[model samples]
Target: MLLGSPTVTREAAVWRRRLGGNPFTVAPYALSCRAAFRAHRGSFDARWRRLQQLAPLLSSTAAEEGGSLRFVPEAPTCCQAHVYLRGDAAALDAARDAVLRERGVRVYSRLRGAAVGPEADECYFELTLGPRHLEVADAVYVGAWRAFFAALAGPQPGGRKGVGDAEPQS
Candidate 1:
């Protein structure tokens, strides 16, 4: 039987504290990573439709305030989805976990990282789909993230970034 999963663990919390709250550590130990995606070739209308489908699933106050959907998956993993947002990262992280849990889609918050541009620093929350046995969740996360990209911004040519079109990482 499948066992219950946790969104965040005390071990992770302790490690975070140990690293002085820096998401990026010098060691870079193995972590359950999620895949990131960019918008793919698609019509603007098609992209809008995909955004509509995703609007309810994801949590974004910016989108609610007549702002654009800024959720971008740019993590270096192949089994998680990363979202960048402004405002309380903790709250949004919890909200995301709750939303996915309600849909029976379990995920874990892997890391919170700094963004590149005008976005908030330490604003991105990387979420892993499930544990090792849940390869199906990994596939779903990849497909959904890809569709999300295709619908919202359209991924650039040459397929998804990070993982470099490689087979799923362990």
Candidate 2:
């Protein structure tokens, strides 16, 4: 399902924990996404760096890297766990038929706006779908990210950043 390799699979696990499904299948997709990276970078360290970039993008709800990485701050909708796979993107008619059916998701909505990712394999990039980081994260996820990053980097600014009430953008 993923266009990329194996370790990037953390992406799928985060989703599976949030989405709740057979993580084994999701694990394979994660490997595939990593494999896609292999196709692009032609090396392992570079691809691993790519995964690390994405790792920070996600807010781990549980321990990771042997509890080295803490969960980053997350938005309400983000932590709520929404995931799905649209089997058919070519379908244009009002009633679209799924070429493949995925289980345990409430709805499959089209994600608009170009999301940036390493230009590895193209097809598998679609597997990278996720909701937008919300305004709520300003109150929560950023704090979590800072804490987690600090925990890994040795504490410097521990909860010193003030999250002033910024108007929620629609």
Please list the Cα RMSD from the true structure of every candidate, rounded to 1 decimal place: 19.0, 19.7
For residues 1-170, what per-residue lDDT tens digits would candidate 1 score against the true structure? 11344545656667778878655652343242222122322333443444344434444433433222344543222333455554444544454444353344433343355454365543555443323333243346444333333322322466632221234579
What is the Å distance of residue 61 in model 1 from its true position? 14
Q: Give the Å shift of residue 126 in candidate 2.
A: 11
CA lDDT of each candidate? 0.41, 0.33
> Whose lDDT is greatest here?
1
- Ten contiguous residues with the weakest lDDT in model 2: 92-101
lDDT of 1: 0.41
The candidate scoring highest on TM-score is 1
State, as a TM-score between 0 and 1, how close model 2 is to the true structure. Answer: 0.18
> Could you tell me the TM-score of candidate 1?
0.29
Candidate 1 segments exceeding 4 Å error? 1-82, 114-117, 127-170
